[model samples]
Target: MMRQTRLNIRWRLTIWNALAFAFILVAFGIGVYQLLRQAHFDMLDKSLKNRLVTLEESLQEGSSVEDAIRDWVGKFGEHSDYFAFVCDGLQNTVGATATLNQVDINRLLPNLINDYGGTAHDSAFGRIRYASREVQSHGQPLRIYVLAELEHLDEELLLVRRTFLFAIPPALVLSAALSYLLAVRALSPVEKLRLKTDSISATDLHERIAIANPNDEIGHLTATINSLLARLDESFDEIKRFTADASHELRTPIAIIRSEAEMGLHNDADHSRTNKRLSSIVEECGRLTNLTSQLLALSRAESSINKSNMKPISIDRLLTEVVEALEPLA
Candidate 1:
């Protein structure tokens, strides 16, 4: 039972610790992934918004959409990774960059007016991060859509997911190892206590649990157990003294009964002396019977103190049996 209890404590402690660590690791990984993803998307949206602002400023200078596109191409060169298009209120494509030709533009932008603001998703492109705004271009209201291929961002997110997946197992393993070590350390005192307790028994109640430190919890526990052992040792000593006293009290009566009986048997010719010895033997036998009954009662009381029920003994019946045994000598 002690071994089983120890195992249960150690396992519960280790498992609970490992589980708590795992939860924290998973939560931290999720939080980091979300923050990184949000930051990436925020930067992408800001860049697209800035580009729209530049286009609006160029249009305000009385430049045509085609002229603005030409200026942008000359300044920044061609980037096939980004696509930009301008559509009039009637949904007619007025201006487009060279990158728009790389992908299925119709699939990437199903409805130029519908793909207006925020972000859009496509099976082929994964995430089409974009910014759109209504702007005045050459005395006409135009909608500008700036779209960027999210393949790079998606690749980064995938790498992050892979890193989490690979890192979690090792992190959990390390956590479990650390938890086991902590469990062992925490239960070491308990193990010592158990060993001390196991070494004690009925024959060796004088031995006590050694207290390494008197201030800690384990130390207090050991002190409590030692106090209990001290009490038990005192009780055992009392029982031994009682037993010795009972034996001493019964020995004289037993010796008198035996001696008087032997004298009566050998001096049968002297009737008066034989009768006197018989009377003395009978008196000693009564004392012996009383003493035996008192001892039995004491033993029964001690035994019954720890039991649920006490079995009553017939003292009269025991005395009758003792009298019958003495009848032969009479």
Candidate 2:
């Protein structure tokens, strides 16, 4: 199933951390873009409104459209991102900044005071934010248009977006790597415990795992396992003691039975059926005596009580035998 094939804890942690970091990073990038875009547009709108207001006042104070355009153009200078133009009652362009073209004037000119006060797209400038106002110029109805290009704004935002795009993948990879390393470090104790547990067997129940700390969760779990092993050791010892005791008790009874059977066999030798029965009893007692002796030996082996008379093996010979035994499997 999918559960069995799923990623390990370390990989899962890395994935989760990467995902969380990606989300936060992307969210921060988007928020920064939104704030900068809004701020740029706000400043642009305020400038356009101020320019329109100043131009309206100039025209109202009996200033000719040409004089107003000249003054505004000089104030803006050569590197200006805005263009100002004026149209008379006939909708003919009477005055405009030096950079204004026929297409820019035609596509972007507002028809009424209510026409524009926000952003618009233009074929000449690609994108522009504009503000328009109707003003009295020498007692004739006049409309003035102010357009600021949105190209710079778009470029700035695009730069910000690109920076985030370039940074996200590397940041996610770094986060994943760090998370994986931390997971491995954190789970090392569990791995050690697993290795230690794997080495334990029925014959080696006395072996124990070392605990570094007794307060943490891993330490507590190891302590519980150690307690369980202790109980198991005690139970096995009890079983061995019972085996030895039963074997010792059975030895004398079986010997006595064999002697009685032999006597009966001799006394009943003239009767063939009775002699056969006594012979069978004698054979069974011999088997029982052998079984008890084997049981006693097993009990002693389990307790290691029969090894007192044995001498220590030579280290060189032991190593050679061990290597020979393992070479085939290897």
Q: In angstroms, what RMSD does candidate 1 have relative to the true structure?
A: 6.0
For 1-330, candidate 1 gives per-residue lDDT tens digits of 565534587788889988999999999999999999999998888877777777767777889998887776676567765668777887677888876653456666673345546667877666677778888866799877777878888999999999999999999999899898999999999998998798899999998777999999999999999999999999899799888999898876776778788888899999998998888777777878878877777776776753334569799998996675555456
In model 1, the Cα lDDT at residue 202 comes to 94
Instruction: Report the error of model 1 at residue 112, Å.
Output: 6.5
lDDT of 2 by residue, 163-259 (tens): 9889888988888899889889989999999889888988988878888999999999999989988888887888977867786867654655556
TM-score of each: 0.80, 0.68
Whole-model lDDT, model 1: 0.80
Candidate 2 — which residues are off by over 4 angstroms? 1-4, 60-62, 87-94, 110-116, 133-143, 245-260, 269-330
Provide the lDDT at 67 for model 2: 97
Q: What is the C-alpha local distance difference test score of candidate 2?
A: 0.78
For all predictions, the C-alpha RMSD in Å is: 6.0, 14.2
All candidates' lDDT scores?
Answer: 0.80, 0.78
Provide the lowest-lDDT 10-residue window in model 1: 302-311
